[model samples]
Structures are given as structure tokens and as C-alpha cells.
Target: MSAPDLLSFAKAVSSGAIRVVDLTQTLSPEFPIIALPPEFGQCAPFRLEEISRYDERGPAWYWNNFTVGEHTGTHFDAPIHWVSGKDLPNNAVDTIAPEKFIAPVCVIDCSADSTADPDFLLTVERIESWEKQHGRIEAGSWVFLRTDWSKRDYKAYANLKEDGAHTPGPAAEAVKWLVEERDVLGFGTETIGTDAGQAHLFNPPFPAHFFMHGKGRYGLQCLTNLDQLPAKGAVVVAAPLKIKQGSGSPLRVLALIASK
Candidate 1:
């Protein structure tokens, strides 16, 4: 009984066998924010007024009442966020199945493509090539787009200049293929949003958001640390705060990558 090594995975608690990788960007005022047209519902950028920094408000406590968009920071997107998935059961973050919050992940390296062009679209052909090397993407695992964009400066990360943000994302066809064919649990990105900067020009527009939500898949954005994981076998933990009737919520995402 004292031999934890004899148990199937008690080794998960053993030293040097597993590691936790933080996959969230810092929720700071300087982080680039998502943009919405002047007419649509607006997503507030994160802002906090220090209630007390170990001072008057509460001598022993330092906290703040902050206002942030449901999609702000390292956040999760529930199906209910878009009208396309509005009617589905458990469509909101508060209602989603808890089991879905933890799962294995596949980080598809797309940083080179993104570096070559800010508007790059992750295509099925590239995924197919990845599979050729990494094996078929297992169903129900997360497919994280690892572009390392989270490492860029705020101006470069957003790449916005009057027209809108310029970022990499899945092609519309690729999103459809992933949802319908690969059966991925969700999509994640290092950029400000999951869709490309100019996705409004694609058919049905914002295809990653459209198809992922419509199919009841989830989204993780404003992510980092993809550079810390291998292509396969990392288990991700992304449990959002239990906000009431939340369209979505910011969260701390962690990944458990296997060690040598």
C-alpha cells in the first residue's frame, strides 16, 4: 500500500513525472483587446480599480471589482455565445458538462505560417500533414493552434490598424472539417480571437466561432505556453468560473505534459 509506484497512475503525484504548464495570458491593462463594431454588443476590456492594496479597504486583503468582457483574457467560449447555438441544452458555460473541462490535447504548430503572414489560415491540408507525422487526431481531444502569437508585443499581437485585427485562425472549410470529421472537442488559439482577423469576409463569416459553437464545441483564446508542450499527449485543464448565465468567462488554463 505504501508503494505508490505500483498503482496505475499514482505516479502522477510523484516528483518529476508530470509538470503543470500555465496556458493563460496575464490579465493586465496592457493586453490587446478584441474589437467589436460600434453597433454590436460590446465586450469590455479588463479594468480594475484596486479596492485596497493591503490598505484601508481591508488591511489584510487586496482585491478589486473588475469589469471584463465574457471573452476577455484567457477565456472560454460556450455554445450559447452565438445565436447559432442558442437553443442547445447546456449551451452556456455554467451548464456545460464538467467532464468536458479536462481532456488530452494536440498542439498543432502553426507559428511559422503565422510569422510568414498575419492573415494565415490553418487549413485541412496542413492538419493532414500533421496527422501524417503525429498520427490521426483522436476524437474528443482538444486541437490547439500553436502559433506562438501570444509571445508578440501587444501591437504586433493584435496587428490592428484601423481596418481591424490581423490574426491567424482556422479556415472556414477547415473548421467544418474538424468539427464534422476529426470530431475535436474544441479549438484554442494564442491570438486575441479564434477566428482570423478578416474572417468577416469568409462565407458565413467567423467560421471558427460559427461552426464550433453550432456544433457545441468550445473555444479557448488568448492562450500561451503551447511552446511548452509536445504535439500529443498533454492533458489540458480549462475550467471557467461559474458565472451565472455566463455567455463565457475568463479562466486559468493549465496543461499536464508528460515528462521524460
Candidate 2:
């Protein structure tokens, strides 16, 4: 865009001609996180430590340290998060180009299906059907699955069973189609993972991680307010923390939508 175009956009934002929607879930200890099996490592929940509350430590400034997992809360998934893209260049969060932090988004609403079935899996047919209604999912765009899972209460949000958590996500075929055919920049979901909760049961388990990362794409998880976005035309800005060699990190996702 030219200098005038950029200036006009800034003015529009200042004048409410455009709306900025926050798509990130609140990061707190209460937020439910993904649980792992007894044999595997686990992600830590968000924690905060109060260093000083204007008492003694520092009268002038108040700062506290906190601990949390890389994938805690609403976070970004770098290509390096999966084995498929481990060897790819710029696969880590810190190394990825800043230009990629922003991109057009295609929100595919699967709320009804997900509400009917906790284990609902997005299929290629569903994606194609959505395309029939909306325009084609252009390359380098973020395709977000809107399941409204973020609205669930704490217990139901995790929805863990004796076997594992029951959640909605993309099927292996859908992941393949998005990566191979559409060439999306990344995939986002209201669920904890880009893949289904029982995705391990699928052939080539966790296909979203397998195919998307393998192609050096990205991922956003634990997102919210997708219902506020239109099917297309919104631009998503998801910039991850610059953790060196980090596989993933919590991020603040914002969607820029033009006013009608």
C-alpha cells in the first residue's frame, strides 16, 4: 500500500470506520489447558507472583514474575512445534518473518455441529461446502474453525473422559486438503489443539500438526469471539512472543474488520 493508503487506514481506525476485535481468551490460572497422559510431559497453567503491591519491594514501580507453559492460554504454534517441520528454516516463533503475523482470515463456522457432538471433526466436504458459499480460501490466509467452544464452562471446556478429552477439530483429510490444496498460512481453532482430541487414533495421528507444520505453516489455539467475524474480509494479527527457539507461545490475536 502507498503512504496515503496507510495513512487512511490509520485514520479509519482512529475514527471507528474499522473495528478491532479481540480474539484471544483471557490468560489466567483458571483457564483450562490441555492435559497429557501420565507418560508424557505436561503444559503448566498460568501463574502469577506478586513481587510488590506498593509495600516494600519497590515503591516506585510494581512488577511481578509469572510462570506458564509455552502453549498456555491462547497461543501461537510455530512450525517447529511438530516433528514434521522441525528441520524447516524459520520454523521457530522468533525467526518467522514479521510480515506473516498479519493475514486475511476465513472463519468457518461449525458451532452447531460441535454443539451437537463434542467430538465433531471438520471434514473436507464441509470445507468445500463452505467455499461454495464464501469465496475460495486464498493462499497465505488464516482459516479459523469457529466452534464456539470458548463459550463452554470450565468443566465442559476440557470435557475430559477416562480415555481423553473430547473436543472438535479438523480431520486428517481436512488438514491435508487445507495444506495441499488451499495452501493456507495457518489454521486457528477455539479448541486446545488444531487436531481432534482423539486425533491420536487417526492414521498419521494429529494430522493438523503433521500436515500444517510440515508445510511450514502456523497455528492458533484457544481463540475466542470468532462469531463476531464475518466469513471473510477480516484481517487477523497474531504475533507470537519472541521466545528464542520456542516451539510456541501465548499471543494476543486481534481481528481488523471494516465497518459496514
Candidate 3:
């Protein structure tokens, strides 16, 4: 297929020839934040206070004063979020090139596996199997691990247990292969973070964040609606707030699906 010009692409979207899917979980105070040890600094939850009412404070308008952590809700992770990427250029949300926000994506569905085992970890063999069916995972494409984990309610979504939250994610080797071999633009998940719940147990810990970002890639968390997309071809739009030197930021995620 020939590449569409910017104007042509706009017209196609405007004409409904291309459909947009909301991949974000709505941000609200009810949404759960990533649980951390009591000793460490924690991310804040979304909060809002209405500053005006039609009767008195503001007759003409209604407004709100809001506060939210950079990583709250559906969010993007910049390279600088981890110490490994601390010295890399354009590592923050504001500094990264805007062109990085849009890219092709590959959806690897591990729904059945994840459902059967809460601690499921994607391995390199599984990724190779996916490639056997869906073609190569091209460099610069967003690779999303679809565990159908987002379908759960707020309680099950986090799946916190005495041992820590039970969740599915890539193994350290898988993360390494995706970053160094497949060269994905980023790794995304339906959970609160790109890494698995038990990732800390791995050597160097949180390999997804460590390898991906350390090498100048990105991540998306709390994503939804992956079942609605094809295994390949969808283009993801993940633009984050340009927070100055910020580690990360909450952002709306959208997927453009071709409707031929």
C-alpha cells in the first residue's frame, strides 16, 4: 500500500475509513495506584476539587482543581524513569521526539495463559511462536502483551496478594530479546506497570523498564481494548504531557485501526 500524506490520513480518519479505539482506562479517583513499600515515595492518585458552582463561585462556568501523579492511570513511561536511562539524551516525556508517539504495533495475546496462571511470564519461545503466525515484530513497532488482565474490576486488576500482586509480564530474557533483538519501540501492558508483579525477584529487577528505557525506548501501562485490535497493523498514538524533566506522565492512549 502506498503511504498516505498527512492531509490524506486526516481525511481518512475524518471519513471513518479509519477507526480510532480508546485504549485508555478512564482516569478517576477510584482508579488504583501502584502499591509500594511504606518506606519509599509513592505515586499519587487522581483527585479533583470543583472550584465553582453556577449559583455562587462561578455563575458562568464550572472548573476543577486537580492533582495527579505523573504515572497515574493510563500513562507513558519515559526513559529517565529508571536510573539506567538517567544519562541518556531526550529521556524525559518532554524531551523525547514527538514523532515517537505514533508507530505500528504488534499485539501478543497471552490471555488464556495469563488466566490459567496469574504469574504467567512471556518467554522468548512464546514470542518466537507468535512470530511464526504473525510475521516478524519490526523494529520501531509497539509490542503489547495482551493478557486480558484489563477486563477485571478494580480489585482483580491489581491482584495484590500477601506475596505481592499476581500478574503476567515478560521474563527478563524476553525483555532483553525484545529490546536488543526485536528492537520494539516500546512494551505495553494492561497492568499497572510494564514489569510483572514478581519482576523484583528477577536479577537486576524490572527488566522491561531496565532494558527498554535504558536503551532509549518507552512503555505504556494500564492499557485496555487490545482484544479489539489485530495482531499486527494497528498504529498506536501515545502522546504524553510535556512535563519538564518529568519521569513519566498520565496520558490518553489511542489506537488507529484500518477498516478495510
Q: Which prediction has the highest TM-score against the true structure? A: 2
TM-scores for every predicted model: 0.94, 0.98, 0.97
Output the TM-score of candidate 2: 0.98
Error of 2 at 74 (Å): 0.1
Q: Could you tell me how far off, in angstroms, the CA of residue 190 lies in candidate 2 after the best superposition?
A: 0.4
| TM-score, prediction 1 | 0.94
How far out, in Å, is residue 241 in model 2?
0.6
10 residues in a row with least lDDT, candidate 1: 1-10
lDDT of 1 at 193: 86
Candidate 3 backbone overlaps, count? 0
In model 2, residue pairs whose N, Cα or C atoms come closer than 3 Å (at least 3 residues apart or on different chains), thus clashing, are none
Would you give me the overall lDDT of model 2? 0.94
- Tens digits of per-residue lDDT for model 1, 65-102: 99888898999999998888899899998999999998
Q: What is the number of backbone collisions in each predicted candidate, taken in the order shown?
A: 0, 0, 0
lDDT of 2 by residue, 31-63 (tens): 998888879999999999989877778887778
Q: Rate the local accuracy (lDDT) of all candidates.
A: 0.90, 0.94, 0.94
Q: Which stretches in model 3 have alpha-carbon errors above 4 Å?
A: 1-4
